[model samples]
Target chain A: MATKRAQKMEETRAKLIRAAREAFASKGYAAASMDELTAEAGLTRGALYHNFGGKQGLMQAVVDQIDQEMVERMLVAQARAASRWEGLLEEGVAYIEMALEPEVQRIMLLDGPAVLGDPSQWPNQNACLLRTTQTIQALIDEGTVKPVDAEAAARLINGAALNAALWIAAADEPHAVLPKAVEAFRQLATGLLQTEG
Target chain B: MATKRAQKMEETRAKLIRAAREAFASKGYAAASMDELTAEAGLTRGALYHNFGGKQGLMQAVVDQIDQEMVERMLVAQARAASRWEGLLEEGVAYIEMALEPEVQRIMLLDGPAVLGDPSQWPNQNACLLRTTQTIQALIDEGTVKPVDAEAAARLINGAALNAALWIAAADEPHAVLPKAVEAFRQLATGLLQTEG
Candidate 1:
């Protein structure tokens, strides 16, 4: 049994988030306004404050939602692959795909760093990096990758992959940029791994 | 003896660029105001218009300044190094150092993507990538590195290096990040270039 007040509150929060995403995506984080966001949501300042503490809170919520969606998608891709290399390839491709997504790309890569206080402390970045490092560690343990510093390698690869994504996101023709980036990544990955002779 | 109008125009254009850099660095591209920019430059709207077409033109000027600085620094480092590996390492380190500089990092990596109409048409990115490819091609021709797709390899390495710069730029304690990223880049570069004995 859901209370009417609680249901209404949840609905208001959801609407605020949707509106915030649209505003942030279109206007970017720095240019977006609280008034505009509230107007888009068709909510009042009272409703906004009652839901999110402030603009920063609204931005954080948006980042968290996008991060969760990204992590879920990566996990699914990782699960579907036949081998570690294949899994990593699929994960890389999936990441590039996520970067091409308009709303997700805007929220996580573009606006996230600008709005979030410190990128090192950014919840989404840290989580994604950790996940990437763990996956690379698993590959190393499985004898698929060379015995190197998994954390460092993960950081390098993740950094490169993210840059590729950002490039595609900023490009005029994202489709063309993505395939070229993915191919370069695949070649780099092949060169990196230690395959049995 | 320069004409009065020409000299005044040069000064006004330089002032506008400086002001625009500060504004874009601080408030970001979308958030920065044209009115505020003119005020900061100590110039009138007419002066701004006469110098640069508008805010977008001013931003382009700022980007051009940053691009020139980056290319010049890399060229100097490459000239000083004794070997191709040394040149590449110095160039990588120089890039990381440049990324630490206050306005350079923001204007180039952060706001450049945000404000610039389309990244593919960004002259700086294209020029830098081509220059790096030429460097890589030279190394390959000298038998200093394995022969591969020079342009693609350059893009991958450049993309990785740029993202490393972006990561450092986005960090709270940039000093702490630079060493780790540089070490990672060093290893990646060594792994990339070491020939089979």
Candidate 2:
């Protein structure tokens, strides 16, 4: 039936994404072999072409999947913080820290931007942007953050964090670079805070 | 004479770069025809390969040329400011403003990043980064900026401006988006300033 076919197709898509993610993480996008990935997924090339359109398309899907996971992880980090303002800061810092992970450093930070264009412009990021904007708006309402344009502040905050990660990943010594990046990110973000009377 | 030949070669290189810049600015990197660009320069594809590797190499040269010009313009903006800290702010704002220019938006901001990878990793950016880092160190010494890692602060500030420009360029209403981005940028930068006792 139609329901069974839909479930089967979903399984096929998930399998392809998982295989492609592993290949991309290990070998990188440029060297990642499509034929090998398809075989690893136990699917044919036709299935890959039909589901994801081709290699670049598969890369996009993998990037999206990874990005979604990153966002979820960030949310968890934010939740653990004691205050909303602290949570926002933690979220930004978490993004910078994730750059230390090899899979994240390679796939999301390096290969993703080179292949898929700007992550900010990606459809998946709009969700993250909206969420950040609302959080910033709330901070502004409570006099915790300066009354700058919420969306604008969100964009700059997000941009700063994203670029810091890129800087860390590309650096010769990522571990040494991580603390500097995280500290700078926190300092830069404090500009949004309302000055205490 | 060898001197005359060397001069002629430099002229050929300049002509080729000029033609390619025009082509890239007008039609973008991918759309611009290499044959037409060489013809426009009164050279051959062979000359292009000789001086630069090919289209990509030529693009690098063009990007370098533009990036150098942009840095010079930013310095001029900085020099016009009342103080060094003000100059730094002016330089960042000037960078954002330049995104409004069509050639910058098309060739440098869009096509250049897509083709050449992250601008931060570009060899030419090191010069700019060093200069910015030195300026930041000066600010820290003067107690104008807080005691943070100057290089890290410099990277975050530069990244914020660059990403802001990218955001503005990609927006449907760039003109309307400009003020918001500029304000957010100014607000975000204030975080690094030493808090008044």
lDDT of 2 at A31: 71
Candidate 1, number of clashes:
0
Model 1, A102-190: lDDT tens digits are 77667676667656643446766566667778888998898988776676567677666776776677777778767777776776666
Which candidate should be chosen as best, given DockQ against the real structure?
Answer: 2
**DockQ of each candidate's interface versus the true one?**
0.31, 0.55
Proportion of the native interface contacts kept in model 2 = 0.63
Instruction: Rate residue B69 of model 1 by lDDT.
Output: 75
After the best TM-score superposition of candidate 2, give how far the Cα of residue B165 lies from its true spot, in angstroms: 1.0
Best by lDDT: 2
Report the lDDT of model 1 for residue B6. 86
TM-scores vs. true structure, each candidate = 0.82, 0.88
Give each model's whole-structure lDDT.
Answer: 0.74, 0.84
Docking tier of model 2: it is medium
lDDT of 2 at A1: 56
Candidate 2 residue A192 C-alpha distance from true site, Å: 1.0
